[model samples]
Target: MSPRVKGAVLGLSAAALFGLSAPVAKLLLPSSTPLVLASLLYLGGGLGLAGLEALRRLRGSGASGREARLGRKDVPLLLGVILCGGVLGPVLMLVGLQRLSGVTSSLLLNLEGPFTILLALLVFGEHLGRAGALAAGFVMAGTAVLGFQEGELHGDVLGVLSIAGACLAWAVDNNLTQRLSLKDPLALVRTKALGSGVCTLVLAWLTGQPFPAAQVLGGALVLGFASYGLSIVLDAYALRLLGAAREAAYFATAPFVGALVAVPLLGERLRPLDLLAGALMAAGVVLLLRERHGHMHTHAALEHEHLHVHDAHHPHAHPPGTDPTEPHSHPHRHEPVTHEHPHVSDLHHRHKH
Candidate 1:
């Protein structure tokens, strides 16, 4: 399959899995405060991914899990993504959930799409064509649709602000994560999970949050594995294959996933606004699927370490008998070349338009 197609699928899958976490977590809230549960969720994700990494080594698979191991130079940026996305985002989101209903919180999380796209366009220099712009508009419109009746006149002001703040933090995290997208995604996932999980778990203790019951701990771990660990690994792949804006656009459907599931879980009545927002979010995703970015670009000679195969883009020589078709990692240099072809803002295609 095309890289973009694979990327979109991964992004959508991640978003869908994340949608399930909110309501299930709400069910577990009686066991502990939002802070402690948030910490446990992250801890679960970290430990789960770490175990997966261990299993990969034990089975001696392609080791794609370690294909693009983290390096010295990657430490600071990796930490940044962990702190912004893994630590701050989930904590603030749970805080908002404290005040808002589970379904409402899930729907409100739609804001992350537009926030991610806007940051991608303005800060990361990602190109946004007509389709992308329309998608962004629909997503932005959806964000407002839920707000009109969120808490009636009084409004859940603190809850909304907290969730919005978390969205912004994740938006920044998504853009920054582009820098590491080309690395081993599983490695990245485990690292972020461990880093954020450990940090938040410690913070929970320091802040005097008590440990939750076993069932609640289990829920947090399970949710964290699916929502944070696996979801984020997929997200990293999407960022690598598709540009941030398009991935964000596709991911906008996450709210719909949550809303649909919550109808039964939360016994949520289908509101008119819910239908309207779902339509808009769906339209946005469809438009993004049609997006295509291709143009003549130059590749400046550079060396980097990441898993790569001998595609037209990889014009470097390797030692005798090395299979070019098999993906491998090395500090290969790209000779300057100019050509026209379809591409996203992937590792080799981060050129200014």
Candidate 2:
């Protein structure tokens, strides 16, 4: 399959994996697992990834070099990402899930996409045109409707607050992950998983939750590996092939998937509004995908080679004795430019001459 198709599939798989977590947690909640104890599931997932990565390295199939090593400069940022996404996000989400209906939490969790988009725009200067704005609005409205139907407006305000906190923390983690210079994809996943898992496990132990039964602990380990570890790997691979916007657009399907899975797995029922919200979410995704076709530009950066054919009528001068630069001139032409910074090397620039 093509890279784009692979990316889309990977993204969808990541969403499905994430969607399963809610129902799985609902099943395990009967064990009276404290939120902190549940958080260890995430930690277990992280450690599982770390172990797999280590095994992969041992087998000579893992990423290597400086990119694979955590440096002093990355420590603070790594800690913060772990704290927010690893420690706080899951803890709050588990607690909220315990109190809220699985379906309700699934729908409310849809807020992550819009929140992520807004944060990307405001904090990272990512472009959000009118189309993106409209998409965001659609998602926001759908989430609000779901929230109202879920009775968050009249329910425990603190539970709502906790879920909101999880959303924000995940948003922060997403943006921070994008900003980091880490290039070894597996290493990045390992770092996130291990770092977050360690911190969360420590907190869980401190909270005095009883050790899970061997069977439950084994289940949690498997869930952690699939939901956290493999899902992240799939997501990273998808993001590498599909730009964040496209990957996120596809990933946005997670909430509906979660709701659907909950119906069968957790025996939860969805109301008409839930279906309506799902429709809106699907529409929003269609809009996001459609935007890609509407806007097509060749984005080239300095220090990279780009080849394009220009027609004869383009009216640009070529080097002496070379073919004239035209609208449809050469079958292929090469252009290369240099930039000072590695990150800026891929930045797009328009040619004047």
lDDT of 1 by residue, 108-194 (tens): 776787888888878787878786798768866765675455443323889888888889888888888887887888888788778
RMSD of 2: 9.0
Collision count for each candidate, in order: 0, 12
The candidate that wins on TM-score is: 1
Q: For residues 109-171, what per-residue lDDT tens digits would candidate 2 score against the true structure?
A: 666766666676666545545775676566566555554553343336677777777888887
Give the Cα-based TM-score of candidate 2 against the true structure.
0.70
Per-model TM-score on C-alpha atoms: 0.88, 0.70
Tell me model 2's lDDT, rounded to 2 decimals.
0.62
Candidate 1 lowest-lDDT run of ten: 146-155
